[model samples]
Target: MTKMTFRKLLAATALTGITATAVVAEEVDYGKFDGYTLRVKLIGGAQYEPLYARIAEWEAMTGATVDVLSRKNHFELDREIKQDIAAGTLDWCVGSNHTSFAPQYGSIYIDLNGVIADATLAEFQSLALENSTVDGRLVQLPRHSDISNLYYIKSLFEDADNQAKFEAEYGYALTPPETWDQVKDQAMFFADAPTFYGTQFVGKDEAITGRFYELLIANGGALFDDDWNPTFNSAAGVEAVNFFKDLYEAQAVPAGSLNYLWDDTGLGFASGTVALNLDWAGWASFFNDPENSKIAGDIGLVRAPKGSAGIRTGWSGSHSFSITETCDNQAAAASFVTFLTSHESQMVEATAGLLPTRAAVWDDAKAQFTADGNNFLVEVFETYAVSMSEDAFTPPLITPWIEVSNEIWPQLQAAILGEKTPQEALDEAADAARIVMEDAGYL
Candidate 1:
């Protein structure tokens, strides 16, 4: 029989990591549009801003100017879009969109089927293009895939004394975990509270909702039945919720973890204080950079762990660009959208460890990594490739996904904070979500 070590687990079912290397790709022809200004709303952060910097390149090539109306995180941008929908103010030409959030926007964004060339659309991964489509309309052009995997301080698992002690206490070798239960055990074992943590999670908003939803699926639980009755209060659901509750109660994570978003958990891991982090590929470049990460050279990567049902937690989405349906200059908007997702543009993002949506970019990026003697990036690309093909799945493509999430998160906080049992909180959240579904005519 083959020995199943932690290092072996990181590949196959074990999982992925990354770093940056610039590759200049040939530019595509985005028609000239002199004397035109394009307006956009973008998702802004360190990992994402590098791609937006290339907007200047797009402008120079096309002779058009870009006016970025707002540059904020997705959660904030989501609220702005929601308000725009409520107030009838979706006047911008193009905006950032996500597969998980696109259904809620109705038809404010134009269909890209005829807008973008079929030849160009053919270059993107079919699964990516499929996720960007809502109600049979290709509402957005995918930028990159968003899938999380495990990242940890490598030296921690490699320490002989620590490994021996952990093996004695847990009756297993101290290695990268193959399952979520192992994750909990290792986390608590490594934790030394207030000074450091075993692990940390994104604590609130649709962020936490996605985390819970994925864990629920991992535990063989469904959020709703075939008829759409909310079923997140089942035994499997309770088990999933307890995963977070136990971590919080044991102080395995930071005291402020319930309020952490991506930045907090990401920076925590980079600071070398946290033992484990499950995060997106976009941050891989930053995490492995010595200038930015204290544990840069000592990092280990693995696929996200499996739950009791043997399913890995794979809550996935894509960051994308979309043109508004009401734009006065549809041709210009289309040109701009096409330019941003072109081969060269994806190459720029690929350097930042952002997973490319363009199928060719993946091959080219991995080739560049191998040529550069960057085995870390090569391993990351290989591990993440398996995840993208087999494990990745989006939340239910429905108009009320965010609305339902609003009801679920607060109750989840209640459960984690010890105010309610997992069942009680999920049941109440389900009651609220049922009303939302009925109001939306899903029931």
Candidate 2:
């Protein structure tokens, strides 16, 4: 990608990342903008809403009102942003961005190197800032990082009958799964259809494409070779696709799973009808609350299972805030994002189980959880921390990522729904993706 002169690769601060130490929160000068109404677009979902509650404090301190124009999921927001870019209608000051999706926007967003104070940027974890950088430009501020870990029903594995039955059928003990094959076997064992399911996944949009990508990596397949030729129709790719297809065909997952997104799978597991769910840490508090979940006290968490190549499935990224180049209130916009990702702001999100981007919050939040006797959240943090460090990785950080994903996911669904064999569907998707890479000058 560096060989080309793409405007999208506006390198942010390409400096070596500095690790923050245990230091006092430096007071920032959030400049007053009285009578100023900052227009913004934000990512909205149950897991992401807690931090928005702090906007009132920023409004009071800065004397500016926040006018949130749109609050939707990432996929919908991506579509809307693309539309805005086409019509030259980026009338807002700030918008939500992700590591995987930020590259698609080109130079629409301002590089934040000098916009945010070096002190403020240094407070964040090195990895989060590194992922937020595009080619060379630091285009966004990291909000919270994300990686999936398996959440399952505790009692199911403890049930004596289940153990005996599973051992008799599969020649293994009934326990937390350690491999993808074990997960398939256990899911099939527990599923009763329409009432109970073995597992569930986000089935459409870039969500499924991401799920497939991680599994493809786990099965020892790369999306492209050194020259960026599409190679996902290889043997390992077929095996990964078959993992989802076989579950769907056997009714081990929800019948409507092909249309389900994150909310569906998260809520399904909490309802106690699903035996397992692979999900992010933000749902930890919600999943364990008796007021919101039927299986509140019966939950067990584990790292995601490994695949045929003995590699764990880990597709990772960060949710972030970005400033628009056209914003009339650039200073105010920078202040807003700084306030949003500040130590205090991140603590609010961390309390709700969202991984903090600011390094200090990790220790402080765990200490708070221990003081509060919230062992579940402590465990949740520990389990997720390892995955974030060891198993985590991002997809190709290229401008054509979402475009390629659009071509791949529909083909993924076709195979999952029996419209085509895995090999046939992947072949068609690979052909389409090759054209995308070629047009983008990666071929």
Candidate 3:
């Protein structure tokens, strides 16, 4: 196995929560744009909305105004941004960007390589900055990173009767799974129809595509060969696809899983019916909140399991902010993005369980969680901080990515639902993806 990769600073501070502040306070010129009403578009959702409350602070600091043109979820926002790009009406100055979605925007956003100060960029994890770059230009400043780990019900694993039954039946101890196959066995074992389920997954759209991509890599498959030819129809790919198909066919996941997305899966786990959920850290607080979660005090987490190749299934990205290339006030826009992703702003977001892109905040936030005796969150940070740095990787950074994804995900859903065999489905999707790449001049 490969040596575990992680940010040295984070690994050194693990569990102990020894506070060592890495972000140096620096005075930044929040350039004066007193009368400027900077129009912006953003991704809207519950976990993301809390950070907007801090926007007023930036407005006050800069003596400028923000005119939010729209606040829709990412899919809607993506369509609008594409329309804006095509219509040459990028009137908005700033917008939300993600590592997976940014490549599709091409040159619509300004390159921040020369705009953001080097010292400020230095504070962020280098991998995040690298992921934000497209064609060697810094297109976005990362706000928070995303990666999944397994979340399970502690009580289920601790029941003596259940343990004995699982051991006798599966020839192994009943515990949090260490591999995808084991997850399947355990999920099938714990399933109890409409009352409870073993686990759930985001079943449709790019969400499922991303899930499949990571598992494909885990099972020793690649989406594309070095020459950009679609190669996800390999045996490894079949294994990955079958994992999901098996769970759905066995009724281990929810019945409506085919239509579910992040919210559905997160809420399903919190409802206490789902025993295992592979999810991002952003939902940690919500999953543990007494008022919101039925399993509030009974959650357990483990690093995402390995596939046949001994690699964890880690499909990762970041939510970020970017300035438009056509902005009327680039300086003001730059200052605003910097302020939004600043150390203090990140601290606020991280405290509520979002994984920080800033390396230093990992230590600072874990320290605070430790001081509060929140061992759960402390362990969460430790596990995710390593995953973010070591295992996290973005989709193929190319302009036709989203277009390619639109073709692949539906085919994936069809295969999972038994509309086609995994091989047949992947072969059809690869043929379509090949045309996409060829039309984009990649092949």
Candidate 4:
């Protein structure tokens, strides 16, 4: 089936959780917002656009109108929101948010704990809700969780010639990698550059910084010491940075990888030229549908590989919604966000492979995939579910996280591009991070 068809079919499947266990089907109410125009700024992308399709339903039910002031990718949307904050023009009622980015917004967003009903909050996964809280404020309502696992072309590992060749050279049978070291070895081995490469990463911005952070944590490193002093320049940090540097040096990843982000990495893997991709569940169907992926039906997956410390790399967060503190219509804004993250709405998103923030949707999504005979998606959820629960963690949830990340990524890029040694790059980044932490009163 085509990728588009798969999505449409999934949405129509009527899997469980039309009303989650904690949600009152008819007892609780979505307050009337008649004639109230709830202005919002949203994060836009193919995977996220479908949920917006239900906006009319909410409008009809509440007799209100939604004014989407802007729709841009998360990075651009974040920049725009910051601009609004600086200009003191937070006229919009709702905006898109992320766990990694919410802290920086501070008091600009109101605490949702009081605005949203406690019963509604109870419907979400406790861990996700906990992560959404920053400095004791429930600033955002999680739309969907984000966590990654490894995806590879299964056919390559199944080839008799390839398996024998790999076994002869590495003294082990060729299979999906179970550790970061094996990933490097296999990626380097499979790379036939200009035609095919072994793996790729989102190499710039907080994208790279977050990647480095998770790998650092997997190697038993922390970004800060007990007193909140910068400590990522430790030996573990050097090791983490070297992994990317070595890949770039060996041409195991794309030549233009340093410029890539999530979209670039997702599309690169779908093009069938990359062997292993660490990606979120949102792309599971896209990567397996012949209409969108050249390697469709040839995909394999596993939990993200472990670092030297035996911990898996599971950097995670959520795409979410928030209400502005300056809003004149907080009640309307609250209702709108609640409806957007409702069980039925989340079910629509989950059908398209986005992980749910509500705990019940996990089992429902898996059961639906099983009923549809989609073993790949079933495995994707199973693997990601475990990784998210056991290995997933966020970057430091502090006001200066983005500022600190900005200082670190450039140095990380320089190291990966061979302009600086890994130790030198991390040392510089650590110095810059220390300044940011100190400025934020963390040091």
Please name the candidate that would achieve the greatest TM-score relative to the true structure: 3
Q: What is the C-alpha RMSD of each candidate to the true structure, in Å?
A: 5.6, 4.5, 2.8, 6.4
The lDDT, on a scale of 0 to 1, for candidate 1 is: 0.86
After the best TM-score superposition of candidate 3, give how far the Cα of residue 347 lies from its true spot, in angstroms: 0.8
> In candidate 3, how many Å is residue 382 off?
1.3
Q: Any runs in candidate 3 off by more than 4 Å, and if so which?
A: 1-23
lDDT of model 2 at residue 339?
Answer: 93
Rank all candidate structures by their lDDT, best first, as comma-separated numbers: 2, 3, 4, 1
Using all chains and alpha carbons, the TM-scores for the candidates as numbered come to 0.91, 0.91, 0.94, 0.93
Local accuracy of candidate 4 as per-residue lDDT tens digits, 249-322: 89999999999998899999999999999988888999999998999999999999999999899888999999
User: Candidate 1, clashing residue pairs?
Assistant: 9-14, 10-14, 10-15, 14-303, 15-303
Give the least accurate 10-residue stretch of model 1, judged by summed lDDT: 13-22
- Show the lowest summed lDDT stretch of 10 residues, model 2: 3-12
Q: Write the per-residue lDDT of candidate 3 for residues 1-443, one digit (tens) a residue.
A: 12244344434433322232353543666777888899989889887898899889889888899998999988899999989988988998999989999998988898998798876776777778878989988999999999999999999999999999999999999988999999999999999888999999998888999999999999988899989999999999899999999999999999899899999999999999999999999999999999999999899999999999998989999999999999999888989899888878888899999998877788888999999999999989988977876677778889999888888889989999999999999999999999999999999
lDDT of each: 0.86, 0.89, 0.88, 0.87
User: Candidate 4 at residue 162, lDDT?
Assistant: 92
Backbone collisions counted per model: 5, 5, 0, 0
